[model samples]
Target chain A: MTVFTLINISLLAILVATALTVSRLRALYEAAMLSALFSLVTACLFVLLDAVDVAFTEAAVGVGISTVLLLGGLALTRSREAVTPRRRRLPGAAVAILAGGTLVYASQDLPAFGSADSPVQRHPLTDTYLHQSQEDIGIPNTVTSVLASYRGLDTLGELLVVFTAGVAVLALLGPLAHPVDARRRDDLDLVDYRVLRVISAMLMPFILLFALYVLFHGDFGPGGGFQAGVIFAAGFVLYGLVFGLDKAQQVVPRVVLWALIPFGLLLYLGVGVVNMLLGGSFLDYDTLSSDPAAGQHLGILLVESAIGITVAAVMTTVFFSFANRRATR
Target chain B: MIGTHYVYWLLFALMMIGLYVVISHGNLLKKLIGLTLFQVGVFLFFISIGKVDGGSAPIVSDDVETYSHPLPQVLILTAIVVGVATLAVGLGLAVRIFETYGTVEEEDVLERDTTP
Candidate 1:
């Protein structure tokens, strides 16, 4: 048997087991944990598929950060449901038939399992990045080049989405309405998490460093602003969990955070304006420098920085809003 | 030896199981887990479709070199991040629901929904 055949069998077994466990498991917490395990396995599959950057993200966000957040949310609430399933098996059967038919229809046109030549490989966009990117952008990693350079504008919008969500959380949640005033308490106290506080404190610097490395390293890899920003904010969140939200606020500063929203937004707009002044289209970095390649790199770097700032600030602000509600109440 | 079609069958089976749990189960966390399972099953399906039976790993090692479908993997990575973000937001909503309802059970939470 081939290696893929063997791998497929194991994967099939795992997916089945995880599904059954999720269905049979009664407790919400157990189910969430099981789901996280599934995500981790799926991430491993991604790595095996040569998607290492994605694998790192899936493991970090899906298995680690998101799971912890879900559990923490669960802790504030009760565990498990009181009701059992009463739905019949036929609706599912009918749905399955429909979905199956749809899948078959779609698969008919799809290239057989990994036909060496497919639209994905031959697509103009990927072709440009794969062949033209090295000379045009001076980046080793085509994915990063595409994400930060070719699609810089899209990344800017994504940053805005994150920033807006952060603001919406704080504005609607009402707990962090006046973060500055409430950040003055005995912020040194770690509450029930003194040990955790110490660990997170030790880890925070490294986490931030990793974020920077990812940001600067994107020229050759999948590390970029959006991912780096999320990771950086996550590190701060770990700190908040350990040292308490109030303490986190003091260090981050309500002024700095609230200001960062506009700052990140303006920084992005500024890049666009710079492009306009330099005689390129809005956000076109090639105009900023005499050499288009240098301009592209600088543009990507600046746009990436903007993305990182917004993601970090937004995620931290949103989490603070969640934890601060009861504390302030 | 099993044929390649059987591999597709297994993928279909896994997908069905996950979808069933998600739609049939009433437990909130169970639903989330099922949703995640359902999503991952789909990813597996796509990744499986991207695999070449005799092709080597996509990595460009000195000893052996081959090309494989790398796009799907990257797309799946994005999906995974989107999945986690959705889960975080969903859990946040669940927390809010619990705070107002004092329970995580679907039926109980629903009944108490109007109470708040």
Candidate 2:
């Protein structure tokens, strides 16, 4: 066996261990931490599977943002899970086993792992995307080209889903209210840690800069608006965690977030409308510039920037909303 | 054959474990965690299917002769972000439910509603 296969098996073993442990934990806080670990391991597995972009995203969203969100949710609710009665557990187990058995029975026909003869590998569309994207979109990253240009409509839909989630959360939780007194709270911010404060302050600019780097570097590398936006929001989340939500709010006011939340999606839609006006179908980037490649590049850059803006804004808004509630309470 | 298929079986095990957690857990937060686990399992399964034995990542490089399928990665990439969005909404609802019901336990909320 190759070294990569060995590593893959080991990581999968670790994932299984973590998942089992997480399922058994009744302490919600420990469970949250373990879930973060699960994400980290899964990100490693993604790397082994040659999905670098996915690995980057899972690390950022699953480990960083999801953990913080889970912790924030824990702060608002109980930290311990209530014991499920033994009588109630049996049916769930039975159902899960039956479902899994059916899946396993069906999976017997699946192609062997990593076989080049698999239907996914042999599909004509895969060949076209891998080769034609170079000539058609002029990007080194097929994933970015496919996501931004070829399947652009799907991405727009995904962005709308994210925007809708932000709006839904806002409606459910209310807007992030400014803390009445920013300076009065002891428990809200980590006021006593001078070392953490100094480090976080130093790291803030680099974090935002790196986020921008990831945003622009996506054409040739394993990043794009989604990962960049999450990293960008994570920087603010770190700031809020250490300094205070009040301070973070000052850095990015709710008014700005409210505007930004929809602006990104509108910008994306506006681009499609422009495409239609320019005598192309919706989201057809070929007509944006004299050269088709240049048009694709410009269109992708604009669309990715829009995605980055909306994702960052929505993430920050959600974090602020959760933190604001705790502060006010 | 069993050796080649072990990964699928393992993934199925992981997925089933998640399903079991989601079904059996009473706490709203635990259920969300289970849902995430299930989502990640599915994501892994997709990525696994896209893998090519001797291929590198999908980034266009002159030196790499073969590349893994980029389509599944693109699909899962969107799914991951959408998954987090769904989680955020779910958490928001959980918090809201806790606020109204004064507990996040499913049985307690049901009992309170039925008793009243």
Candidate 3:
């Protein structure tokens, strides 16, 4: 076998090893850590594919933020608990098998691996962005153009979904600051949580800075509202993790969340309302202004900011629920 | 022959094992492991779909100008992040469940919780 082929095989083998390790891990904490490593490897594979934006999201969401949240959540519960397997496993099995079969069938019809000229690579949409994006959108990254301008409506739905998730979390929790049993409340040594405190103190600024950079730098690269929004929320999540939920909640008060919910929702809706009021149809930015490009940029910016606010607010709310489930109000 | 496609076969096998773990394992943490393995199966499938034999790195270099489409790789990366986030949320929920119930098994936790 060629050296390249050997390396690919090795990579695949490592992936299998990681999967096995996850299954065999007796400790919950170690399993989470190993899974985090697996995520890192998956992200590395993305980098090799030239998918830079996806790589960034994977790194931030998977290895960096999610792992922290899981570990923190684990701290609130049992560290290691043995639980036996249960019966009634057939329905899920059948579905998974059916799904697997369909997936295998789908793979059969796909073009052979690494075909130089696939339909997707040679599509008109690609050539349109590659050739004309500079003069039209004036963006460096084609992904931005597609996600922000071409497929903006879909992104709006995603933002709305995030906001809805926040509301759902709040609804599920019932009321804010309702008391649960004292024993259920985690009793990790708050005073001794020196590592978390120190790390948050160090990371909080860089996280926010990076979020902002991603927010604005999106037009020039593989970023925009969704990625930036998620990252910004991740920063607050970090704070919640380190400083304890109460302290983190203090920084981002309930009033802010209450206000932001409507504000973000209104901001996104208002843009569409404005568009309807103008000469164009709903969300049709031609009515936004005389210069279409200017209108597109404005629409993208306002919508993106709204998305960021809603995402940050909703994620904080979700984490808040996890911290204190008695939020009835 | 398609029958000799080791990568595809491996992917399906891992997928089955993951599904089995998720269904049979009573522990909350085990469910997460199963969920991850399942996700890894998807990731592998996507990567394999994007694989080009003799396909050099997607990065633009002086010597070689041609490269495979980098879009799928990018999508997979984002998918990885989303997968991790879901896992984190899942684990966090498991932790909270454990704290309240003092057990990580789904059946045990369900037995204690009232409908009210």
Model number with the top DockQ: 2
Top candidate, metric TM-score: 2
**DockQ score for model 3:** 0.31
* Per-candidate TM-score against the hidden true structure: 0.82, 0.97, 0.78
For DockQ, candidate 1 versus 3, the one ahead is: 1
Q: Give per-residue CA lDDT, model 3, range A1-329, as digits (tens).
A: 56654555566577668877776666878987887887777666655544566666766666656666566566556556464433445665676688768767766766654555667656666456544655665665655655555655655665665565566555544254244421123442253678778877898999899898888887766666557767887888767656666676678887787788668768988898899888677677646778887887787777777766776666666656655642111
Chain B of candidate 1 achieves a TM-score of 0.84
Candidate 1 is graded, for docking, as acceptable
Global lDDT of model 3: 0.64
User: Candidate 3: deviation at residue A193, Å?
Assistant: 6.2
lDDT of 2 by residue, B22-47 (tens): 99988999999999998999999999
Off by over 4 Å in 2: A176-186, A327-329
List the candidates ranked by TM-score, beginning with the highest: 2, 1, 3
Instruction: Give the interface RMSD values of the models in order.
Output: 3.7, 1.2, 4.8
lDDT of 1 by residue, A1-329 (tens): 66865775686678577767767777878877887787787777665655566666667666656666666555556566555645545676678667766765556666655455667655676456555776788776655666666766765665565565566566654354454534333433467676776777788899989989988987766677667877887888777777777678878986788778678778988999988987789877788788999988888888878877876776676666556544211
Interface RMSD of 2: 1.2
